[model samples]
Target: MKNILRTAGVLAVASASVLTGVTAAQAAPSCSTARVCLYDDYWFTGTPRSFGWVTYNVGVDSNDKGSSLVIGPATDPASPYVYFYVDNNFAGNNVVFRAGNASNDLRGLYMTPTRNWDDEITSVWG
Candidate 1:
């Protein structure tokens, strides 16, 4: 009886640990911490391009292809804002996203009244 009780307790603890891990995994974002991740599809469904505290043009392949983005903590504490630019080298129209925020869809985001951000992002900086 004593051995059985001990085994049951151990199993219960193990089960609880597994449940906790699963919950954490589901809640965590697909992107890593302290980096911005831009997705090609709405709702962050597509493979993301991650960026640190540098300027990236995203090249032609990723240019004008961003539809959503996830913002993480800044690489440096001083700069906690992320910028998405319509032109390379951080030029042209831009949008800002703060730390710990995310834009699941970019269709509704407009850099200007006439220009939507859905597929106009060509570069990123944070």
Candidate 2:
């Protein structure tokens, strides 16, 4: 009887853990509805250069706000490398960049309002 009780307890704990994981996963935001804009070979002029604008509706929930910018490789022929930005903030360098190869040229953008921004950013980058 004691062995059966122990096994039942273990099963209950395992089930609880699995359910918790599934619930957390379900709560996570998805980028399926994310709006993406792409541009090619553009030059920078000044601070806050407009890459593009995103205007969401009342019902749409955005995980973050930013655009992905691509720049040509230094020597490789891979067309361009990807950079990210969030709220106009650069992801990799933590410094803003221009459209081309400016000092702060942003390869991409990603901005999240939640306290879990760091985790979300890390996940996105990875």
Candidate 3:
């Protein structure tokens, strides 16, 4: 009886470990095929601005400084059609925009070498 109980416990633990690994793997996002598209104009000013895109698999930190867009596998970071900004006018001086549950889209729209620009994000598409 004692041996049987120990074997059952080991099997239970092994099953749980396998299940947890599967869950974690499923939770991770794949950006291999994801792409983002961005428009060149802002809603308020309608001014044509040139913006670039970069792909980041790791999550964005709130304290980090720079103008960048965060995207997921379904949404390509290379093409950000929407313009989101983190400017100096906001309370925390940080802006985070979420598009879907599969991946979180972060836009550092207002980050400039000299200062931050508080502006509205025009549009976003995957």
Over all chains combined, what TM-score does candidate 1 have?
Answer: 0.71
Q: Give the number of the best model, judged by lDDT.
A: 1
User: Candidate 1 on 13-119: residue-level lDDT in tens?
Assistant: 77876887543322336556677777888767676787764556777677788888888876677878888889988999888888888887799998888879998
**TM-score: the better of candidates 1 and 3:** 1
Kindly list the per-residue Cα lDDT of model 3 for residues 42-123, writing each as its tens digit. 2212222222223221122222322233333335444433223332222233334443322222232344455443323332
Error of 1 at 6 (Å): 23
Candidate 3 accuracy as lDDT = 0.34
**Reference-based TM-score, model 3:** 0.20
In TM-score terms, which candidate is top? 1
Query: What's the residue-level lDDT of 96 in candidate 2?
Result: 27
Off by over 4 Å in 2: 22-126
What's the CA error at residue 48 for candidate 1, in Å? 2.1
lDDT of 2 at 84: 38
C-alpha lDDT of residue 69 in model 3: 32
lDDT for model 2 comes to 0.29
Pairwise lDDT winner, candidates 1 and 2: 1
